[model samples]
Target: MSEAAIVIEHVARRFGALEAVRGATLTVERGEIFGLVGPDGAGKTTLMRMLAGVLRPDSGRITLEGIDVAADPERAKTALGYMPQRFGLYEDLTVDENAFFYGELFDVPRAEYRERVTRLLGAAGLAAFGRRLAGQLSGGMKQKLGLVCALIHTPKVLLLDEPTTGVDPVSRRDFWALLYQLREQGVTIVMSTAYMDEAQRCSRLALLHAGEVRECATPAALKRRLPGALLAIAGSDPRAIRDALADAPGVQGTLLMGDRVHVRVDDGGLRGPELEARLAERALAHAPFETVEPGIEDVFVALVGGAA
Candidate 1:
């Protein structure tokens, strides 16, 4: 097995009356992409902040490469790079200038800083825009610049809090490509995201809800954990079919997706005839229903819908 790059043990954090994080525990293995998957207010940010050594956990411990974060935040930080939801980029400064500032802050030697900056900028496709003011760049370019600054000092682990939350789809793809390249170079990444599809891309995932980890495993394993087979019914009004099948026998859960309603049933035997009977009773017999492979979003809904 690969060595663990980060570990959290029964960590909890509170803000006044709110329990932001509760007894969360997980391990991120070296040279892998680990995703913190959850919706807003699911304690992802709180947990990430604790891991980044920015916020002290009220209880429990966090370790980066066997160094206790709370005990020596400075030492822990040296080996880690954290990009919060809102990465601080000086809009007035040019891209090269921003990289220079961060390099200086990290006390990187002048010669090494120049060489690293050139390589990083080239890799990020930002070499052409080195002299462009950050404020003048597009949202995607700005995000890329933020990433460049974070990597200026060559940290071993990278922690990102929803790095692609507001980025365009193309940019999100580009951002993920960059992450995969970093992983190839043996950097452990721990990132939190609300996007279920993005969660599917991670090598391992921790599904969190209401400040607690609901499940943690590889994406395939988590999807397999879903209790039943899923069927997709395409129709004009999914909400109607969902309501009609709410109390149907063998039906576990029904969720509306786009123009289709995903129905979870106890087994494959419940599909054709049994499902048709339920639909016919509600005059939804014409709607097309077929068995479909369950996605990570389906698993997340099945797990969190009840508690929600």
Candidate 2:
């Protein structure tokens, strides 16, 4: 197993009277894909910034590979690559030109830029579009170029803040592939995402809410933390079923997933059949309901007291 690459100790950051990050403590294993999962204004970006040595913590410490980030930020910067939520490329510059610009920023040798640029463009599936102006690229392509620029220096730790916010599904897939490729090259990635599916892809996750981490564990471990069993109910309007079950006798929360409504009950052994009977009484037809494992989104929703 790899060593721990990042350690956040009682880290807290505030903006005016608002606490952006409230004593958030988490550890990221080296070469592992760790995630900070939460909604907007959940302090994920603030935490990532502190870890990347770009934003200083107000009350606690952030360390990377045992080096104090606040005290030795300059030295830490060289070993960290941060892709902020809005790190955009110069619109007028070509894809290749942007890569070269970032390479120079990292002090990469001019003679090696061409080879490195080729590899990055190939990895992003933009090898044939290197000469295209960044402004001409689609949202997905722009995001890819930003990622390539961030990786130009090949830093040991990569910190990405919602790198797929506005990207299309296909581009999101490509972005994750690039992340896996980086992990294989021994890069430690600490990323934040509002998408629950993206959080499910992480090896380990920190579920954040209101600037604090509510749970930290693997996806399986987190799901197991859900208090009860899940049952999928299919009906005409799942949202209506969801609303109806929110305060139902023994139900925890009703989560809508596509055409089904996941009803979380306190006890599947006792309430499983009983809940179905009640639904039948209301003339609300549903498919065969069975006890099933809870998903990451379910666990997160339950942990955060139902989504926003």
Candidate 3:
């Protein structure tokens, strides 16, 4: 097998004059969960669409395994399974019926289809609800059903575009469990998500903003790359405290977190007495300050501005 399960090189996409994806490039290893992390309108969905052979890029190349997607989309299509952000499943059809319909689309044999459907339904915890109509299921169940439908044919590559956008906490947990199970079976997954926490769960991540990749690395590696030390400051008025520290000398960035203010500064410049003296001079009552490790969310915001 090739070292890369998927390769995107100098890929650019344009709708008229608007460049949705600008020179985007990345590679995914086989059997790994590679993530695209960005906010809405960051062009992740457009990039994923090109990889799935649904849309052609304006320039550059996309190859699944080793075959070029544009050169032979049908071959790429056969090996790829795509779940769009809002997947379409027949509301009137029962769970089993929906699975059967999709299995046939992938041209699975009747015998193999039956076994695959049964296993997928069980794995999604929908075995007992096979007879229930899709419309009657919960939001999470609908999402799982969409996933099972996409997996009916067991394609080598799986593409999911924001698969868990609005799901509840419990449903989100179940959905991630499903991804882990697929990973164990050696299925390579490339997904896009807006949730920072979800990005931490992947083997590696590509942080996209403003239609470009700012950084790509394991979550731990990204955290370790923070530019400076971080300190947590507490005061009687947390919001006021944050405002006071925003433009203070040595403060690089000040972000409010719950009842405390997260202060970023040059390494070794942010100290307890310094922060306390500053706050006290402003006639503010604040508790003792302490340093804390930076989190992915903070790192993401600091590295990629909200505009991106």
Candidate 4:
């Protein structure tokens, strides 16, 4: 068996004049949960679509296991299951019907789909809702059903695009539990998410920005790679605090985390006084700058462009 589950070599895709993906290349190992982390327009969806064989790259090559996606999508899809951001679940159909629909699409035998859907629905906590209309289900429940449908054929690789977005905290927790279970079963998973916390759950991550992969590594490694030291300053208005330190020398970037503002500096101890001095001019009442651990969001904002 090959060590890699998915591989792409300088893949490029475009829609008219818009370059959705630009020379993006990454690899996902068998049984690993790889995350694509980036903001909107970062090309996460485009890259995912290419990997799932829904769209072909205009240039370069992409292979699922050993099968080229562009050259032979049908053969590649036999081992791939894709759940787009808005999974095409028939609103009027029951959960069972939806799963059956996907099963038939994948050409799974009726007897096989029956057992598989039963187990999947139960594992996703949707056993009792099998007869419930998809339109009536909660947002999280719908997402779970979509996942169940995606797994109807038990594909070797699963690609989920922001599956947990807008879900309640408890539901999100439940969804992640499901992902952990899939990982244990040795199912290779690649997903894109806007949530930083979700990105941390992956085995490794590829940070995309402006249709390019800026960085790729484990969560801990990405945080450790954050240049300079991070410091937090508590303030009544995080935006104001960020603005006040905007022109502070030696500061690399500033990010707001709730009521606190995180600023990266060449030297925290030396720059602390300067940050204070700058804020003092604006009469902004802010707590002392204290060293803080860097978060994945911080690394992303530092490497890719995001709102201050």
What is the C-alpha local distance difference test score of each model?
0.88, 0.88, 0.88, 0.91
Every model's TM-score:
0.96, 0.95, 0.94, 0.97
Expressed as tens digits, the lDDT of each residue in 69-132 for candidate 1 is 9999999988998899999999999999999999998888998999999998888889999999
Residues 75-153, model 2: lDDT tens digits = 8888888899999689999988899899988999988888888999999999999899999999999999998999888
| Backbone collisions counted per model | 0, 0, 0, 0
**Alpha-carbon runs more than 4 Å astray in model 1:** none
Each candidate: RMSD: 1.7, 1.7, 2.0, 1.2
Q: Highest TM-score: which candidate?
A: 4
State the displacement of the C-alpha of residue 13, model 1, in Å, after optimal TM-score superposition: 0.3
Candidate 3 lDDT tens digits, 62-112: 999798999999999889899999998999999999998999888999979
C-alpha root-mean-square deviation, candidate 3? 2.0
Give the CA lDDT, 0 to 100, for residue 132 in model 2. Answer: 97
What is candidate 4's lDDT per residue for 111-173, written digit by digit as tens? 787789889999999999988899999999999999998988888999999999899989999
Q: Where does the lowest 10-residue lDDT sum fall in candidate 2?
A: 237-246
TM-score for candidate 2: 0.95
